[model samples]
Target: METDRQGLFRLPFKLPSSAKARSVGVYIAGALYAIGAWSFFDAAIYSRKANASSVHVTFVDWIPFICSTLGMIVVNSIEKNRLIQDAMGSGSFSGSSSMAWQARVILFLGFALLAGGISGSIVVLILKFLVKDFTSYPTLGMGVNNVVGNFCIALSCVVLWIAQNVEDEYSYSLTL
Candidate 1:
């Protein structure tokens, strides 16, 4: 990026090169993941030790968080290079369309699980907390925390995907 050094025309911030940016992006994603997990765990602890209300964090609340975490694992486990190589028909198994098909199937399932986790969180919030008229913050916060945690997990995954691809893009540019 070129800088315009003619006085006040300069931008406030500088953009990093993809190679330089990947590390920072990965760190940010990891931080978000940690914060998300911490937030959900806090809710559970509060429910057990501090909460005075009838509401509690049971196995039901854990289901959505588990689903989202599993989805993240499934999604990140797929080798992106394989998808690209299969698309370009340049792999050692280039003649085998089944590999690509299987990859796509797995990718779809992972995304479905991710979406389902978030949706399930909302359903629990409505059906369990909101519908019962538990409008107080102490009880309502458990549901809210679940939603936030699941959302952050999804966001962390998105950031990681972009961060990983940035390195690949930088390498590709160099090859060209």
Candidate 2:
């Protein structure tokens, strides 16, 4: 008698498995929320500081905090939606088994980190543009720090995105 041979598993490289994407999304959302919260607190503290005028804090610090908080909420919603889609096996996972959902979750987290970093950079840029005449302010160093921080965030996001792609390949190989 002759036996037929079959491949162990089909590779999913075109897009991350839905679960992985969702997990990454949630992680990103959570991180964004944390950052936004921290920013809000920092703004509040700065507003109370004697050196920083209330008007400056309200126009510069509070405005950025509000923007970041709003943006984070949007990110959270996106992540939640992705999670739902993954849970239902709605997108690329349609008709697929749930066996790889965990891996999908991990990938989703990685993506979230990437998204958060990128979003942070954008927020920083907005703040930088909104604030003018740092030299006239007592916190010139702080202003410079913000610029550097934004650059770092953008770089981190790119790195995370690349890592996610590489990680996916490695995970796929392990399963193979």
Candidate 3:
């Protein structure tokens, strides 16, 4: 006799299970990251080429972008299953546990850096532009671009996380 088992409720929205879907998500993430990078570059280049004001793109403006990119790289490089296994008590103290501890520390650092990057952008926007009373669009645009680019990178990280979590679905045959 076969028994019916209780299952968790499914979401109304479904992610595609095909490998192509995964590839598409990765491509989209890359595109978003590129857009963010280009936006920052645009601001920098604009400042060099046509800036009429004293305010310019400085090293401070680049720091947030660097932090975010580094965080994304660190977060993506971790093998997620190992962490999960460690959490579930499948890890040995000498080997798996140590690795898991390292992974967790690194992961925490990555997320901290990512959050710092986004926060730093907002700080620059306020302190550099708004606080200086530079309300004019041309002078303010550099700060705006930095904020927007950091936001785009954050979104790219989200997309990549969701894409990585999606699992392949298949069916199994039952014999009576």
Candidate 4:
């Protein structure tokens, strides 16, 4: 009777069929980190060429860079966790499945684009307020782009946190 009962319970909730789904978040986080790191390097190079770069890094750049790096670390850690491996031993989160991962990739890209747009608009507003001669240089556009990219990156870190939590909840629910 005990064995029969155990089988009955197992019928409704078996191990996840695959581990493939949970990787969506990992991949998205990895890509964001890569892009942010590349941009940081690019900015450093450009600043060197201009010779106008500040010897002291401003709060703006430093904060976002740190946050993005942390986000990358989190993603890597999640990928390495044993629970995740066990869960996938049955099946992965429905959301992390191959189709779901693809959807997530699209969603991440959309977020990136949205963040870029918002950041660009903000930088333009700042320039309009601070620069008396706004139309003087072509480089102002580049400056604006940089500011916006950083803003987007920082914001994405917050989004990533929320997303990780959501994924955890979703994974738990699937197990039940």
Candidate 5:
């Protein structure tokens, strides 16, 4: 049987898949998430304090961000071993199957929330800001920030996932 392939792309440069790289990826992901959160916060503040237009950031504008943050937390908290072993059909414990099932369910929910957040952000931009004739950059920025913030959050999740998977594979390589 042919073995399964690994890594999305083979790079010309050999990047060390070390623990340090994993740590850096995690830190970068966190920073991206923070930037996303701050972007939304800045938008809310600008709307509250300096916005001359009637358009202001409201609770409706915050739902997407909340969902994204919660999703990130859920996605990052799952133990990777469970997911991998489950797929590989290696169960040492009686409850391993159930644990894997739970992990899958939770993981699915997390991804759903993440996707929903991105979609919701776009919806808010179009329905709440654009439709209301908030054409000027200053006023429109509120919605734009929401979309950008959610996108950054999604990117953060991707970085974290790649980092985690790479770390696991690195460990496997060492064992072999």
Candidate 6:
């Protein structure tokens, strides 16, 4: 005899099965990146055309966004399989410790740039706008947008990394 047991209710979530469905993460990541980029660009446009305040989005503001973008590119350009193979100690390219070390260093640089971009945006927000008397919403919003945009870009990078395995779907690795 079997008894019907009352259990905790769970939300229904149908997992996607197709490879195309899996790639949706990439699309989402791209959309996030686009939104971030558009936000920053909009800030610049406002500064150029609509801003009443003397403060404007300058090259300093662009620096963080550029760094973040470059970091994203670098981070995603690496092959995750190389790192995995090196750690496992078996693969066609795993024989050379220097290769693994190089990969690690490059990956570290990429992450460092990403972190630096976010921090730099915050620093700009504080030192440039907040510290000054530009407390008005319009002027302050520029700095705030920069910070938000960089953050979104970083988030997009994370999403993209997860979606594409740091963006290398097919790693060229040969096992021995």
User: Highest lDDT, which number?
Assistant: 5
Ranking by lDDT: 5, 3, 6, 1, 4, 2
Give, for candidate 2, the lowest lDDT window spanning 10 residues. 2-11
Candidate 6 lDDT, 95-125, residue by residue in tens: 5577667877898899999999999999999
TM-score per candidate, chains pooled? 0.80, 0.34, 0.81, 0.39, 0.82, 0.80
| lDDT (tens digit, per residue) of candidate 1 on 1-176 | 85542221234864354766889988988998898899899999999999999899999999989988888877777766545545554434344677666876787788788898899889999998999999999899999999999889888877776566553333643333
RMSD values for the candidates in order, in angstroms, are: 7.9, 10.9, 6.0, 12.9, 4.9, 8.1
Tell me the spans in candidate 1 whose CA falls farther than 4 Å from its real position. Answer: 1-17, 90-96, 168-176
> How far off is residue 142 in model 2, in Å?
6.1
Model 3, 74-146: lDDT tens per residue?
8777766545545555334344577777877887888888898899998999999999999889889999999
Model 4 deviation from native, Cα RMSD in Å: 12.9
Winner on lDDT between 5 and 6 is 5
Q: Candidate 3, after superposition: displacement of residue 165 in Å?
A: 3.8
Q: Local distance difference test, per candidate?
A: 0.78, 0.42, 0.80, 0.44, 0.83, 0.80
| Runs with alpha carbons beyond 4 Å of true place in candidate 6 | 1-18, 90-96, 166-176
Cα displacement (angstroms), candidate 4, residue 76, comes to: 10
**Residue 80 local lDDT, model 5:** 67
Model 1: C-alpha RMSD to truth? 7.9
lDDT of 4 by residue, 76-160 (tens): 2332232233334455444345544554454455445545445544554364423645442333433444454555465555445
Lowest summed lDDT over 10 consecutive residues: which window, candidate 3? 2-11
Candidate 4 overall Cα lDDT vs. reference? 0.44
Residue 40 local lDDT, model 1 = 91
Error of 5 at 123 (Å): 0.5
TM match of model 3 to true structure: 0.81
Model 2 spans > 4 angstroms off:
1-13, 18-21, 50-56, 71-133, 136-138, 141-176
